[model samples]
Structures are given as structure tokens and as C-alpha cells.
Target: MAEYMRLRQICLVAPQLAPVIADISAIMGLDVCYRDGNVAKYGLENALLPVDTILLEVVAPFQPGPGTAAGRFIEKTGGRGGYMAIFACEDPDARGAKANAMGVRTANVITHAPYHGVQLHPRDCRAAFIEFNHTDGSDDILGPYPPAGPDWQKSIRKDTTLSLTEVEMQSPEPEGLAAHWGRIIGIPADGPVVKLPNNTFRFVKGDSEIMSGLTFKVVDKAKVLEAAKARGCAVKGDEFLLSGVTFKLTA
Candidate 1:
């Protein structure tokens, strides 16, 4: 059953979704797919990209409550956006059952007529939201989402463009956090990194995004920093702020 789960999407939540979307686009030279309607009933708005058939979405909440989900996330971590790695399942209902059997409760379930998605509590994953969903009336997993407006393929076309590889996680106790996430994702602890079939998750002891969960790919790390600087982006170590979002580069 665990093998049946597949990587689906990566979401980044911000206080203002639009600005973050714009920031990533300018730095990456890609366009975002603005869906026609809200994906969540919680007043969350989004923009998406088809990153190797895995949707990458940036989302934000319109209101407040412990942080409108998106808002709450910003308040908790001070707006350093990270990935909310979603997974595809054979059956969302059965997945929910599995989670319940494991004593994990679904955070929110959405039945938006044509699509069904459930957000697992962040407490379950720590530092991120994990969503599972199966759409109705279509096997077009990435098709329903719009094109990212430009030839995103071109960004990767360059030999220097490294794939925005894996996300890293950081906690007070690196070993404990690694083991905990290993159980959730069915991956084993490999030294400081938890090795999953699709992605490698590294765990460290720190609160910074550079030490914690961050999105990376295979671009000329130095070149990305240089390009970001040319665009008036603020740099802090390897992480850069452009448009209002942060992009961290790693091998």
C-alpha cells in the first residue's frame, strides 16, 4: 500500500500568494498557472506549475484564524516558504482509512465536485502539509492544471540547470526527526539523510530554511545566485529573496 503512494505536488504557502508566485517566476524564468477558482474552501488562492508532471503550487489564505492555514504557517515560520509535498493515492478514502488506523487524523477533506483532496495534519509530518487526492472524471492528473505560460522545459534545457532536487528537514534533534519522518514516508535513515525512492530528505539540527526543509534542483548554484542578484534579489548565504519569495540552491 505504501508503494501505491506517488509524489503529486509541492505547495508553497505565503502571506500573499501572488507575490510569491511572481518572485519564483522572475528568478526561474517560468510562468505560473493561475487556476480559475479557489482550490480550497478556506479562502486559499493558488498558482501552479507542472514540474516534471508533479504540480508545484503556491497558496495563501485570505483571512485569519491561527493563520488561515496559510497565514498560520507564515506566523509559525516567519514566511520562509517551503514545499508541501503532496502524494497521489490509489484511493483517497482508503488512504484516509489508513491514516486513521495509524491514529493520524485528516486535517481537511475537500470534495470540490470534480476533485477530491485531503490534507494530512502538519503535526503528522512536521514542518509541512501532506495532501492526498484522486480526481474524478479524469486520469489527467497534470492536465487539469494550466500551462505555466512559458517553455519551462527551456529552463532545464541548459546544461547548468540542475533539477530542483530534494527538500531537507531540520529539527532540534536530527536523529529523532529523521527516524520519525522515516516511519511516515516508509524510508530508512541513511546517516543524516532519510532516503526515499523518489527524493532524498536530509535532517539537521537548526531552525533556518537552509538547515531545514528546502527545495533545490540542479542549476549552476553560483549562476542562480548571480542571476538573482542581477534581479535585485537579496542574498543570505545560498538562499535568495526575489519578488517576495525565497529560493535556496543546493546540489
Candidate 2:
């Protein structure tokens, strides 16, 4: 099995980027790290924010048109939710081969100089899309993650939000879905959680298979929740629903 070095990034989608981006910036007290120019080629727009070493991204379609994957994703998942989970690994080719052998569809391959990324089709895994990337010869966990754009780490701001502590994947059959994802990612599904070096991928019960929520280690959970409420998000217990996903804060 190819070793996954760390949790590099999490991609979420919104119906529209404006409101969601504003809400995330205000509630999390984080700024946009980079608006990747490459996304426009995919008929989408994106904004990434670095919280500690992890990249939190929100993607939206550039225009409402048929056949665009982002548009279809919104309709499939019923508008705005977690879309993709990316990890940095020591060897992407070996890991990708493992998934390919397991009957996972290879969606796309991206390469730019020293960085190489492989994207797997979401349907094959029965959850969200999974991506494995590697920067040639880079071993430092805190080092460059190319998908978030160069200099993403330089944009790290830690006032309210810190690290992405957990990713919550919801499905009616969580155990089965977890096993599928575990096999695809080369991580063992131990109960409902797949443990990574920097974060945990948690599978929980829901109506369907989707990435439903994210848990962040925050500097001030109450204050963050309060900010979320002030920004017109409906507060529920320790979480606030935004962009069709629940953002849970923990101190």
C-alpha cells in the first residue's frame, strides 16, 4: 500500500460563490489564500483558504450550463456540500494503480512541473471524489501542496479557525461506504473512522452518501458560532449550517 503523508485539502461546493465565500471568511476569520486561475478551464471558480497547514476550498460553477461537473454535483447532492477530499502522498502512481485495479474509474490526471495529481470518479467510490497528489521529492508534511496554488502556506491565518480536525461523510450504509473509501484510499476502515496523520475521515449515518459536514479545531468555538449566526446561518447546537454543509466548531 502506498503511504499517505497527510491530509492536504478539502473541497466544498456552493450554489453561488459570493454568499458562501463571504460567510466563510466572516465566520472563520480567514482570508482567501488564492483564487486558482486553473479552475476556469473546468467551468468553475474557486477560493482557497489555509487554516494551519490544511487548505479549505469552496468551488462554484462559473456559469449555469449543462454537462459541467460542478453543476451536476450540486444537483446530485442537492446543492452545496463537501465535494472532494485530497491527500498528499509519497507516491501517487502506486496508489492510483491500486484504486484502478479495484475498478475505480480514473477521472483526471494533472501535472505541473514537480506536482502530479490523480482524481478518482466519485461514483466508483460511492461518496465524494478522492484525489491523491504528490510534489516530487517533497517529504515535509508542512511543505508545498500544489493543488492549493503556490504560496498557500504564506496565507495561513489562525485567529478563529485552526486545523480541519475531522471530515464527516454521511451515508445510510456508513460501514459499507467506509470500506469502499478505505480500499480506494489505502486506509483501513477502523469502525466509522479512517485515521490520517493530520485529520480523521468519519463516516456517519445520513439519508445518502455525501460529505455532510466538517469539524474544525477552533480557537473560540462559541465566538465562531456566534459569528455564524450573526451572518444569518441557522445555529444548531454546536454547528451552523452553511453552503449545504454543517460547519462544526470545537475548542
Candidate 3:
């Protein structure tokens, strides 16, 4: 199999899933694809929605405490931000090994039958958790993705939101953070941007290093913004704050 990697999923952390999930679905005109029971083992409850081919997931800690990673992240960020950037790759272990060599410690390794994933430490990764995963005999982008659940594609709705175009990673030292992420992902940084096949990661100046925003292509930008306002989102210009990240809509 030829080697390749792409942004497969973006996971956001929330204290509770209620309002966040509801607001996103209403504003973006998206449908919930799945709520993985597997996460319950880790004291988490999650919901995944398909944003074109990219899965958008929100996870909340049911058992909030220092023992739960999600709970700690919520307290650390004051309940504002994305959690992880999960990439679909040809070789997960190889990617983990490379990240480890760069002093990015491996946080966890998940293996369930045909699927395998490696999660790197968030502190070392800088902004968010970096995870590389692969499913055996499935190189096709739309093939059997175990995390998004079976028949996730059937729930895809593009009436309002067209596609996720860019992820905005913010840091005081934007260029340096971009270069670090580039090295981990094996993609050389182009100035302050890391351009992937389907999406781009734009590093920008901010108070702290974090996944701060997401840019989306929409069928009707104004309509989406109006929906966001109705859902009581804090709207400013072309963007609205939801699930702790700015959702920027473009026509």
C-alpha cells in the first residue's frame, strides 16, 4: 500500500454534550452519525457528526475528576477548545515512532482487531492531542472507519455546511508551532501553514497554543450565521463561537 495521511477527524472537548451538540447540529444543518459506546470505558460520552468526509466529534466527561483526561482538559482550558486532531495514515506505529523520536511521548496505543491508533501526549504536541490511526485493508478515504460507526456516510447532510476547509491553530510563536507540527506529521511547514491534501492547518498569533477555530465552506453563509444567532451563539463578523472554537463560515 502506498503511504498517505489525511485529517480524518477533529475532536472537541466539552463539559457536557447537550448544548454543544444541539447547537452545532442546528447551525450547521448536520446530523449525528454516532455516539460511540466505547468511550464510556474512559468515563466519556461522545457524539460524531460527518462534516463531508471529515468526522467532527464532541466528547464530554460523564465522570468529571482528575482521573478523567477529558475532565482535566476542560478544567485546564476553562472548557474552551478542541481536543485532538486524528489523522488516517498508512502506518500508525511508524508515525508514533517518528513522533517519539522528536521527544513527543506516546500517551496511549489503541488496538481493536483491524483498527490501530497511537495517541501522543498533548503537552509535548503543544496545542492538541495528535493521533494516527489505520484500519486494516482499508485505504479508501470513505471506507470502514470504526470510530465514526457503521453507515456514518448515510447521515451526511450538505444543505448548509459544505465542507471543513481549514483548522486554525493559534500560538504566540506561530511559525515555530507550525514547524513542530509539520515535523510530527512529516509535512514541511510552508511559512506558518501546514497544507494537507484535504485541509490546511493555519498557525496564527494568539494568547496561548491551542486549536482555536475551524473554517467551513457553506452553501449559504448568511443563513448559517442567522441560525447560529438563533441558537444564542456569540457571532462576530463571519464567525461564531461554538464548542469552544470559532466556526468561520465562507460561501
What is the alpha-carbon lDDT for the whole of candidate 3?
Answer: 0.93
Model 1 vs. true fold: TM? 0.76
Task: Score candidate 2 by TM-score against the native.
Answer: 0.95
lDDT of 1 by residue, 135-178 (tens): 55335443342223234333223344334456666676777767
Worst 10 residues of 1 by lDDT: 145-154
Instruction: Mark the 10 consecutive residues where model 3 has the least summed lDDT.
Output: 136-145
lDDT of each: 0.61, 0.85, 0.93
lDDT of 2: 0.85
- Tens-digit lDDT string for candidate 2 (1-251): 34555788899887788888899999998888888888889988899988888888999897874557888998877874688998888787778899999999889999985899999898997778898888875577667666677777777888788878998999998988888888888878998888887899899998888898999989988899889889999999899898878988888
Where model 3 places Cα greater than 4 Å from the true spot, the runs are none
TM-score, per-candidate, Cα-based: 0.76, 0.95, 0.98
> Against the correct fold, how does model 3 do in TM-score?
0.98
Question: Where in model 1 is the C-alpha error above 4 Å?
Answer: 63-67, 81-83, 112-115, 135-162, 208-213, 236-238, 241-246
Candidate 3 lDDT tens digits, 1-112: 6789899999999888978999999999999999999899999999999999999999999977766999999888987778999999999999999999999999999988
